[model samples]
Target: MTRLGVTFVATLCFACDARMQLATRTSDLDEQLTIPSDHDLELEIDDALGKKHREDLDRALDAREPGEQLEHAQLSQLALDRQVFTLDDLFRVGDDLFAYQFRPEQGLGNGLAGHVGIEAGPGAAPNLRRVQQNAFGGPDAMSCGDCHAVGGDDGAGTLTQNTYFRGDGDRTLESDVRNAPAVLGLGPIQALATEMSSELASGRAAAIVMATTAGTSVTVPLTAKGLSFGSITALPDGTVDASHVTGVSPDLVVRPFGWKGHQPTLREMIKESFRVHLGIVSLVDQQAVRDGRVSSSLYGDGPWYDVDNDGANIEVEDGMLSTMVAYLSQLEIPIVQPPDDPSLLDRFARGRAVFDQVQCGTCHVRSLTLVDPIVVTHAEQTENTASPTVAIDVARAGMRPKIQAIDLIGSAYGVPLFSDLRRHEMGTELASPVEQIAGGAPIPKTQWLTRPLWGLADTAPYLHDGRAPTISDAVRAHGGEAQASRDAFVALPDDDRSALLVYLLSLARTHKLVAP
Candidate 1:
């Protein structure tokens, strides 16, 4: 067998072993619980559990009277005991879990615990003072699914739901409103970014080594996804000169998650969202505060250990956070769904050609290849061990889906995420006054990452701020590096323009519970 085949077999065997170990652990836990043999009875139990917790939550909220405050332990116990059926239970289940997390629900307490009443205002709830002082924008929305409900579940946001960021407590001024982009197909996008970053870093490192050994200045062109970031010149004395670097970090890492391409990883994005949107801090962020790496002041005016001061040091556990990331990473990429009408299909085909002709593919390059597919596993570690000795299939983490076949657009794994994952200088019209800081450096106000066009049709109210309501508006809004392409698009005849739009619309993938 080929080396690749051998490696594949070995990995498969390891994964299967991990799953078996997890099953054994799960069986042991099941033995401890007085679970019903009948499936219907089990569901009934789950519903009863959910209902009881809801009642407990209400009682806790009531206790938060003028002089009464519920402790963290009371709130923690009130959080519904998450049902674990299969290994997938370790993470989030796409069906009801997705629905529950996204859909707006009553009595679901915010990060402040049941301290603040569900209703907003100081007069209505005594704990409102604590909320107003601590929480960001005072509990902006109930669930993440609430805001991102435009095209479908986890879709883009509307103008009304625009997130006001970087403000001094007041929403009227000193804050910039940003529209939430769709979270679909992020797994492949992240994988592609990781690969591209490694390539750029390796190139710079090799250039630096050559310069130091040869005692001469060496220059390395920084490139990723066929786009040039800039060049780095290394001197003989090992002093590196990066005066020409642009878009990406001097370290050559491409962070392709946020609007400004700021977040290095999806995990970081999730952590920040918990703090900013939900006003919840992850265990990881809490540790950063305790170690004095991050200031406690940033988390708001609360207890040093428990920022929200609900007495819970950890707002969102690491395992829960990891599960959320896994759920997001596994979201299916949008697929091309051409209209059944022959005429429309023809138009879509023509528009696709026009899309290439207009050079939109230059920046929004058709597709990217993942160097390594994302794989996450959860397990316990033995004391004094350097690494985890036992592997377990938490959320079926060890069982990765088969990589999708490449499409005509050149997307590997059949994910038509049309983006080069590079930052470009958008013209003044689309530029924002607020500068996005990433890796301790401020990104240019006008610079933005190439928005992936995979699910363009579904994600309406386009552009960074949802300024453009249609795809055509977004196309016209393009400037700076995209000026020529935008001009070409503008000059196109009516039929051709319509065809291009049709083709873009075809990129919308139908929503599914799980990726096939």
Candidate 2:
């Protein structure tokens, strides 16, 4: 209701590349800005939220003061819709957002422990109430940069930044400890997934039609973008036997984000991250209140929907998600930078050959051909009003050194992503203690998403969690579907193995060198 700053709504993006530099620099407001890692909410409680007309919600707000404020108003989504801001401008704004450190005054947190979003109702992760205050404890991080600062901007998180999700907030062992993944080249990844899902759906539909027409069972190999995803058998009765289908969701959709690959779109993934990591609810979250999905913590007669009763309405505005996606989609792609030295370069080549020799490329495929480069964002009517989309050509229009731009508009090129973006059984060694509950159902404990290894060299402490300190350890820790590759890597000669590591280490992300 009481919107601030920019004309309409847009924010929460374009960092990780610019975040570390900004985050490392001290700010004048640094001393006063902090989320105390303690459940000492005794001082947070406050008075009336203006009226008795909405007595129950207001009383709840008063009791749980929430104590949040907004320092800067968000940018309007109209800026992108009306072409008032260019792609570069959107990226720059998103960068500012990604680096902006939130304080209590700017509506940061309302309990990530003991509850998910400062509440104990249907929204709470029931067992997680008395968890650690912050520091991988709950939604206690002050900013995305706080955790995503280890390797580079939008890089992997270190041990300190690991987060415990969907568990008893009090204890570390009871929760899911996840290492924050690098947030680079997400647009193409999501696009590839979208295309894959469509192809799979079409394949399934064709099988169904054939089966119905022929009045017999029709089995078809599930191929998308030239790779096989096993097969599906369709019977004449319009029933599909998907048990033979491999490596994808029951819906046949590929989720390129998350350790378990549950998220479908950048908008959904980014919004979820803000809520789970920063306690900042977006307009989409407000929609949850209307849908009776997530509880509404409305405070007083404000025009904006207050999700956590933090009094900071529209914390992450409606349009911010779209631009953020645009910014993320355009960030620089990772490069296969081999060492310059002759011996080391030789090792890199050997490792590349060995990578295939040992079959690591079986799942960690060297590259995938993307037929189309256009990644469209914000095409849905999420939080009501202004459902506009910006289509970015992933092969062009990004923060320079666009390494993967060879496949120009409407062309196909190999994306050296080193991932199939499919789920695999990681065995007990790499598996988590508990199954990750996503979209209501529980994902199997051993099934893990194939992490894109484009930025592999920079993202430290590998694996689903940050258990493996080095890449070698991560390789040995592999099991289930990757067990064969892991064993082969282990049995390799010392020199061969070293060469393999060199090849893996070559998978580095590129950053601009700025001379100040």
Candidate 3:
């Protein structure tokens, strides 16, 4: 068990008519967070919060009227004014309210939102039989943090927690299992993806214009952060041909969020995850269902406002969604921990050289420097969606140093996130039976975005399916474009192989302090 000392600062807000001051209190407790432990650390931490605070939270939750929206800003002000809350109270209240275990009396109704036969609305069917079949059905887990709690608090999931999709409720042979990836360093990844997408789109657009004006076909090379996504051929007819496009979407947008790189932004990913994994439909999806843009069958019944018919709307209102995204957007990047022993340091250095010599660095490009770190706030349009925004204090959100390291070669904000963020052919062995359509085109199951290795040391049971028990197993499992690299790794001398593994293990990330 890990013991953490956390302090909370109470601020008095007088700007608004409501005079509130967050009450100040201190408590020393053992915080069970991160790594594999013998005990149920999460439950222990929750129990450690004491009965009084838990009751207060329960009362506050019960006080909310059904269908009423919880104003994040207002609640935050109240929390600060009340000062008797824990540090978790400040961040988890608005974003993780529904994440807590709920009882029937609390309006959650048996606390199993995804159980089949639960009436959604008037004459509506029970929650759909299949998890991930569509939004508002099957409920894989109770909360987002539940699946992502393998290595640590908010870490990746284990093989047991792997989500099975495209099948009946039972784990049938037809189901496809997807290993949950860690959510760390996603803020920088989103920023890098946004930049790469803009660059690709701009380059392709220019090529099209030039080709049309010249009355000749022009090939535009779509390259960003040292990764090439083949090229786009612009014909003289003012139309673009994407037959040569290898990696990204035809629109040249780089979506680096999902396993297939389908989700474009963190906010979008959060909303979709809420709907698909937890059956917490967002207001946007609800409206889409109401407008017939989405099938009403996807969600159960008639009362569109309360699709799940769980008494409260509890549909992950826009404010709650934005707050969750903000929390995710400010997560710390994986830090590379150097070995304390000199001999171990020497071995790690040798392994890093061996890694580069074996050509594994080709797809796993070490770092991509950002000209300017993209700061996504609630007030700005970060993605293509029209979702409502909320202003989040980045400093207060608990983030490590924005710039992980400096890339002199790239001369930008160095992000040592060991990935090119481009899709690659992963060969038949890793390919799925079904195809995933993205940006109006069918994506081959074998093609996937290169998995970033920044937090590789902590997140184990590697690969998209958590099939590999060790790092070496994951390397050996690599095929297609990485076949040559895998072969080289296999052929390396024993000492070199050990060095390489040591080097990889150095890439670790620690949990961030919710409060100082």
Candidate 4:
């Protein structure tokens, strides 16, 4: 039941023209796209040769300047006019982990426009030396791919000017929280997203995000436009979901993993990937740095951002945090489905024993192990050659590689496996006080986190902010702490939940990477 592919109009038209500023067909704002009559999304734009890229989105929204704005020099002139703020070979990585920013035609485009970013408007002021990090412990933060991106092609290469900050308010977030979660196909959805870790109950139950006006401080830029990445709305069954962000508090529901989900593994979410998305700081000794409580009046003054023109004042050192967590823990998860069929591997081993006789294997737990492949080859030789040791010990001693654990034959070969990496409560009839975590609280509109369910039959409008679509309407829209595992998967019998939805549409698959 998973075959929805015209390759989803070229992966949602290259993820909606690289997430936002839509209307593609090589858009230059393609007649400022308005098709939405609830377009529901299929996106096609030709509108008569879309008046040829409207002067390249009006010279990329009138290129600004404040010590060379949106640095990496405007994503290298929008990747020399292939356009849309360039940096898209779908995040490359070839010449042996592209030897730290290689050069030739400079294909990796100076480390992919040094992680793409530059929109100084919306009242734009806060660059206070690129607001380093405060994360948990709070205030001062910046990590939208530290400009726009980092590394891939079998991974390791992020270093967008190492920055840091710790504890002081008015908005700071670099205690390394991290939220990338879009690795394409993550090796058969890392064992069908850890089959919901057998009703977890322990992994330290994290997710905190406090500070609602307590004397009114302010400083929250990670971007999705001013810090509010959760909240969708509209449901009396019209299904929109995600809606709970007012003074938040039920232990902070961040559940995206790390600095809160406290690392249950994506190899500890790729060793807290470059202090969770570019606040830098990663030698991998792990945790310790605290100090907070200011409230207001603290914006400039001290070593922030003129980084070096000898206007003097230095202090930065994330140097691409262990090469962006060794090119994101050796990326290569994209398997989606290739075994091709040996009687569909005996009906995926009889839907892997009816996904462990429902209880969805208690918070989706199955096989485990992956955390030490010599700390993932010394975090990919400390992210490409500052040399932390790389011989690949005879190809990891004849391919011992780990990161696997899937189910439903590894998501029918791709995603919807169901999760358990941690974080769940799922009740306020499926809550959404606008998603958050890390102390400020409010994460239990039935608190959620065990939702990996890889490519759940080709990315849809599902939970964790997508809200449910199918798979029995996301198991009858599961209720609080998954209402006794959705009434034990609705008392199974209908041909064992139709053989567990034919073992979750045989865990569909697609993206590919594998080469070490």
Better of 2 and 3 by lDDT: 2
What would the TM-scores of all predictions be?
A: 0.73, 0.78, 0.76, 0.29
lDDT of each candidate versus the true structure: 0.61, 0.67, 0.64, 0.33
Candidate with maximal TM-score: 2
Better of 1 and 2 by TM-score: 2
Give a tens-digit lDDT track for model 3, residues 152-256: 756888888877765555544556667889888777788788888888888788998999999999998878766788888999988988888878877777889
Give the TM-score (vs. native) of candidate 1. 0.73
Instruction: Give the worst 10-residue stretch by lDDT in candidate 4.
Output: 104-113
- How close to the true structure is residue 250 of candidate 1, measured as C-alpha lDDT? 64
The best candidate in terms of lDDT: 2
Candidate order, TM-score descending = 2, 3, 1, 4
lDDT of 2 by residue, 1-516 (tens): 112311121132234323332222212212111222233222122111211223344345545654311222135665556767777667755665676667543556542224334553223321222233332234557777777876667777988777877665566675777888888877778778988999999999999999999999999999887788899999999889988777787678887889999898888888877776776767665766757664353211123365454556557765677767877888877767655443354566578778999999888887777777788876343643565667887778765435353434645756778888888888887777776555455668899888888878889888777988999988888999898888999999999999989888878876533222
Rank the models by lDDT, top first. Answer: 2, 3, 1, 4
Per-residue lDDT over 1-516 for candidate 4, one digit per residue giving the tens place of the 0 to 100 score: 122432344466664543232233213211122233333222213311231243233335435432221222122211322323211121221111212321112111111112227332211222233333343221123433332222322221123232233323233242221223344333333332232231121111211011232323222221110222323233232322223422122222333342124333344444334222322222222111112232211222212222111121211122222222333333333222312332343343445567677667566544223322322222322233343322111112211122332343332221223443456566775554334334454344345556555434544434443345467877778776567777877887776676566556554433222222
lDDT of 1 by residue, 1-516 (tens): 133643454455564654343333223222111222476455556644754564455456646742121122121111222322233442333222333431112212233433434433212211321122222433455456756777876788888787767654444354655788888777677677777888888778888899999999999888865678789998998878877987786667799888889897766787677566655556655666667777776664455555544445555554444455556666556666565443354575577789999999987887665545653432111121232211222112322332354556433453357777888988998887678778777788888998888878888888888889899999999999899999999999999999999888877756432211
Q: Model 1 scores what on Cα lDDT? A: 0.61
Whole-structure CA lDDT of model 4: 0.33
lDDT of 3: 0.64
Worst lDDT window (10 residues) for model 2?
1-10
Whichever of 1 and 3 has more TM-score, that candidate is 3
When summed lDDT is taken over every stretch of 10 residues in candidate 3, the lowest stretch is 22-31
